[model samples]
Target chain A: MHAIQQQYWAVRDYLSPVLKESKFKEHGRITPEEFVAAGDFLTYKFPVWTWEKGDPSKARDYLPADKQYLVTRGVPCLRRATSLAYTDADEDAERLLSFGDGSAAGGEAEDWVETHAGRQSNADSAANPGSIDDIPDLDGDGAHEDEGLSSAVGNLSLSGAKVPDTPHLDDIPDMEEDLEDDDDAAAAPSKAAPSSNTVIDGSEIEVANGNLLQVRTYDVMITYDKYYQTPRTWLLGYDENRTPLIPAQIFQDVSADHAFKTVTIETFPHSGTLQAASVHPCKHASVMKKLIERMNAGVVEEQKAQRKSGSKDAKKKWMFRRASGNGKDDKPLPDDEDVEGMRVDFYLVVFLKFIASIVPTIEVDSTTAF
Target chain B: MPVVQFTQFSSLVQPTFWHELTRLKLEVLKLSDASVPLTAHYSAGRTIKDRNTGQEVALGCNFTVGSESFDEKHSLPPFAVVAKGIVKNYNTIDEFKNADKRALFSQAADEIWDSIEKDHDASALNRFLLITFADLKKYKYYYWFAFPALVAHPLWDIEDDWKEAKEQFTDKQLLSLHGHLEASTTPYFLVRPAVAGDGVDIAPVEDYTSFFANVPTDSQTIGFFDPSPHPSSPGWPLRNLLAYLRAVHPTTTSTLRVLCWRDTEPAHESGQWKSRFGVLTGGPAEGKPSAVGWEKNPQGKLGARAADLAPMMDPTRLADQAV
Candidate 1:
C-alpha cells in the first residue's frame, strides 16, 4: 500500500470510535477507494491537469509489433523510481540472474562452494555479466521466443518497481505552475484565484459546502471595504447515523470571521400615557358622584335642621357673637347655609348650592379617568 | 292729705345742687304715692345799700312766710317764710308798691314755686317706670355697642372653625369634590369660605351709621328692625339654619359672610368694636363697607380678618377708669 494510504488508514482506525462519539460517521468511513473517487470527481468537474511533456519511455523501442500499441498509449511509462542497495553477493546475484528452466544444479554448486570456503562470496554479481541466467525451455518445442519471455518474466520478478515520494502531475504543467504561484498569492488574498489550473474555484467550493451537503458549510469573507478582509470556512459535517461534528479548524475559521451579518428579531416601547387610555372612564365619574352626593346630603341635612328651628335671626346673632368671640369655643357649621343672615343673597346661595352638588362629581370623574 | 311745703327765693345757685335736687325727687318718687301734695312758698325781702356810697337805696330785710292750721279746737300759729335780697333804690314803701315791683317779686316767687312743684311731682311717679326707662336707654346704647360685637363674635368663631374645617375639607371633601366635578359633573364656580385672620373691611363708624340712615325709605335697610323685643334670645335656632345653609350651599357668599361673623371674636370695650368688625383690621378684597368705624382697615385682604380687640380695648384700662 502507498505510505499516504497507510497513514490515512492508521489515523482513521485510531479516530473512528472518537469520530463516532463525536458524530462524524461519514468522514470515519472515507476509505482509499472513496478518497480516490472523490478526487477523480473533483478532477472531472474542474480539471486542472494537462500534458506537461512528450512521452519518454525506453521500453517502447524494444517492444514487439503486437505490444507496440501499449507503448503508444503510454501504459509502459515508468512513472516512479526508487533506490535499492545490495548487502551480499548471493542476494545480488540472485536479483541479477535471469529466470530459466530449472537451476537446482547451479544453486547446489553455489551452496557447495560457499560451504567449503566457510565464508560468503564477496562477488558484485549485480554488475557482472556472468551472473545472468541461461535460457531454458519447459516444452522443448524449439520455441526460443517463449524461452526468452520466461527468462524476462523471471528478471522482472527479481526486481520490484519503485514508487515516487511525490505524486507528479504529468499531464498538467499549468496546474503545477498554479500550485507554485498560489503559495505567494495565498498570503495576500485568501479569496484570490487558487491557481490558473485550479480544478475548483473558491466560489464553487463555497456553494457546495453551503448547500449540496446534508450538513451545510461555507467559507465567509468578512470585509472592511475591500482593503481588509478575513477569509474563513466552516465545515459542518453530518452522518446518517450520527450528528455532525465540526472540526476544530473549522471552528477557528468561523471565529476568525465572526464579524459577519446575522439575523435578529424586532420589538416595541412602554409608556404611562399610552397605558392610561384603556382605563374605564365611568370609574372616576362614579367616585366623583358618590363624593358629591354625600357632601350634598350632609349639607341638606344641616340646612333642614336650621330651617326647623324657626329662629334664623337669633341664630345669626349668636353666630355673630360666637364668631366675635375669637372663635374660642364655638363649633363649626356645615358647608352650606340658609338665606337668612347669609352674606350673599338667596339666588346666589341657591346657585352655589347647585354648583357644589355638581363639583364633587365632576372632580371625581376627572381624577378617576386620569 | 299731708302737705309737704317748699320755700323759693331768687338767688344765684349751683347747677349741681339742682341736679342733686332732681335726684332727690326721683328717690322720693321711688318711695311715695303720686297724689301726695307738696307745698312751696316764696318770700320777698328788702336789700340794704353800702353806707359809704349813700346814694339813697332801699334798706334790706329778711322775711319769712308762715302757714297755719287748727290741730283741734285750739288755734295754731303760722310759721313764717323768709328770704334775703338786695334792696331797691325806691325812697318809700309806696314806691315799692308799684306794678313793676310787685310783678318782679311775684314772678320770682312763682318760678321757684313751679320748679318745686315739678320736682315733687316727679318724685311721686312709679319706681318701675323709672327703672324701665333707664334700662331701655341703656339697652339702646348697648345695641349700638353690641352690633359690631355680635356680628364679629360669631363670625370669628365660624371663621376659626372653618379654618380647621377647611383643612379637613380640602383633605377630605375638596379633593373629592374636585374629582367629581372633573369626572361625572360639570364644575361649578368655586366658593371659598372666609378664612380667619383674613382681614375684613368694616365700614367706618360715620359711614356705617350714615349708610343705614341714608338708605332710601323704600330700601330694605329698614327691614333690619326686629319686631321681637329680644332678638338675640333665639340665636341658636337661627345659627342652626345658617349652618345648614352653609353646608347645602357652601359656595354661598352671603352665607359665608354670616358664617364668618359667627366665627369671629366679640367686641367688648370701645375701639375693640373696630377690631372685631375687622374694619379697624381690614378684610378681604370683597369691597364691602366696614362694619365698624371705617379707617381703611390696614389688614384688609381676602377672607376673614381677626383683630386682637382685647388688646385694643384693654379691659384693664376701663376697669381702672371705672375704679
Candidate 2:
C-alpha cells in the first residue's frame, strides 16, 4: 500500500511543477500524463468540493449538484462514465417508435432526433392527440402529396380506387371512419390483428434538452450490425447520478454527430428497425465462438499453464487483452464457467480501450475503470 | 502483464437463448408536422455508374418542385454512387412573405419512398423508409427512417405477410394502415455498429448535400455511420436522405417507425409453422445472462457450472486500515 501511494506521488510530483507553471504547455495545454497528475491533485485529491460547500469531503466526483457519477467498488469509475453513466430513459423512448403511434408523434411532433443543439421541436406540427381519422376528413381535399400519388397515407376518405382494395384494410380500425368515402368496398383480412405491443422504457436515458442527467440502470444498448458487420452503440448518456442534471446531459462535449452516430438495423421485410440501444461494441461472434470452443475444450487452462512457463504462444494470444497486466477489472479473470459473462467482459474491455483513445486529455490509470 | 479476455465464457449470456425479447421500450411522440402535407413534385432521376467497376445504378426520383434538375454532369467520381438525386434547397427565403415558402421546401421523402418501394421490392431495404424531414425554422436537415423493415422476415409465411413485397407499397404507406389505430406500440431506439469494408462507401456529407444548398455560403454537417455485414448498402439510401435533410429543412428531426413487439403470442406460431419456432430459441445466439448455469432462464442449459467467484472478483485489495 505504501509502495502504491509512493508510486502515485512520484508520478504526480514529477509532473506537477511543470503542469502548474503552464510553461511546459504544448499547443496551449499540458500532456495527458501532466493532466492526470495535476487533475488528481488539483481536483480529486484536493477535496475542493467539500471546501466549496464547507462540508466534510464527499469524494471529488459527486459534485455539489446536477453532476452525478457511478460508484464502482465504492469508487467513481469515470472511464465507464465516459462511455455510459446516466441515461435519460425518455430519450431512448423518443428514439424507439411503435407502429400505432407512428403518425401522431412521428409525422406530427418530431421528437425523434439525435440532438446536437438544445431541444429543437418541430416548427410545423405539434404532436396531435387525434388519430388519422380525427384530422379534418380530407374526403376531397388534395392534401400534401397528390391524392392520386398518396396510395398509402393520403386521403383515406376520398381515394376510393386504392383505399377499398387494400389487402390489410381490416387491420386498420381507424380507416373505418374514413371508409364512408369508399363505402362501396371493404373486404379485408379475416382476423383482427392482435392488440398493439410496443412498450418503450420511457426512463429517460438522457434528457431531450440534454442539460442534466439521472442515475442509469441501462445506459447504452449494443447490437451486431450485419450490414456494417460491426457493433453499433446507442449513446444514451454518461450519468453517474451523483446529482440531478438536465435530462439532456452529454458526458463530455462530444457532439451527437460523433457520439450518437450509430448503426441502424433495418429489419427489412419485417418493417422493424432495431438499432442497438447504446454505443456498445459489436465484435465478430467468431472471436467469441473461437474462445468458447477453446474454453469448452479446456484449451485455455493449458495455455495459461504454458504462459506461466513462458511459452511464446501465450505472448501472442490476443483472445485475452495481451496488453493489460492487471487482467480484466484488475481481478485477474483468467477463467470462468460463464462464457457469456466473458463475452460481455470482452466487449466492455474493448469498448473501454476505444473510449480511452477518444477521451484525449486523461492519463489512463488502468485500461478499464473497473 | 497479461491480456484480458472479453468472453467470460459467462458474464453475459447469449440473449437469443433467453425467452424471446418480446417487450421493447420506447419514447412515444405523435408526429403532427403541418409541413408534411406540402405537395412534393418529382423529376426524373439520373443513372449513376461506378468509376472503377463500370457498374450503373439508378437513383430514385429527385423532388424538384417547380425547379430544374441540378444533376452533376461532370465530377470526380467516388468508388460508387452512394445516393443519387436527393437535394435540400437552402435558398433561405429571407422572410419573403410573398414567396410560396411551403412549396419552396417540398420534400423528396415520398419520392424516395416510391422508388425504394419499387427498387427494394423483395429486399431488406424495402421494409425501411429512408426519410428526410425539413424544418423550415433551422434550415438544416435531419434524417430518419420509418424502419425495421420486417416485411419479409424469414419467419413470416408468404401468404400471411403483414404487408407483402409483391404488392409495392412504401413501408410508411403500409404503416399508415396499421400504425394509427393500434395503441400501446412504441418504437425502441437501438443502434448498430457501422460495418465498413470493401464496397462500403460512407461519402462525405458534402458529396450529397452540397447540391441541395447550392449557394456559395451554404455548408452541411454529416452524421456518423455504422459498420455493416452487407456491402454497397444504405450508402446510397442514407446519402439521398441526408441530401434533402441538410439542404432544405431547418433541422432533420428524423424519426423512424420501429415496431416494438413484446412476447410472441402463442397463437402467432400455432398454425402451419409451429415447428419452425424454436430454431433460434434452441439454436445458438440466444440465452439470458446468468451467474450460475441454468439457474435462471428456461432457455439455458447447465452446460457447465460456473467456476468459483473468488477468481472472477479481485482477490487482492487492501482497504481502509487493512483487512
lDDT of 2 by residue, B1-323 (tens): 11110000111111110111111101211232222221112111222222212322222212111111122332211111112332222122222222232232222334433333444221122122222232223212222112111111111111221211113322332233222212221111111112332111123222433333432221122222111101111111232222222222324313211111111111222221100100010011111111110111111221111111111111131111110
The model with the greatest TM-score is 2
CA error at residue B43 for candidate 1, angstroms: 55
Supply DockQ values for each candidate. Answer: 0.00, 0.02
Stretches of candidate 1 off by over 4 Å are A1-370, B1-197, B204-323
Q: Which ranges in model 2 have alpha carbons more than 4 Å from their true place?
A: A1-248, A251-302, A306-318, A321-370, B1-159, B162-323
In order, the TM-score of chain B in each prediction is 0.15, 0.18
**TM-scores for all candidates?**
0.10, 0.21
Q: Residue by residue across A1-370, what tens digits does model 2's lDDT show?
A: 4237535644653454322332221112222333233332322311211111111232122222211121111111222222222257435533332334333211443344432122222211111111112123235655554444445333422212221211121221111111012211111111112122111111222234452222222222222232222333332222232111111122232222222222121111111221111332233334434444444344345345434544333222333432233323322334544322222223323433344443221122233212
Cα distance off (Å), candidate 1, residue A197: 99
lDDT of 2 at B22: 12
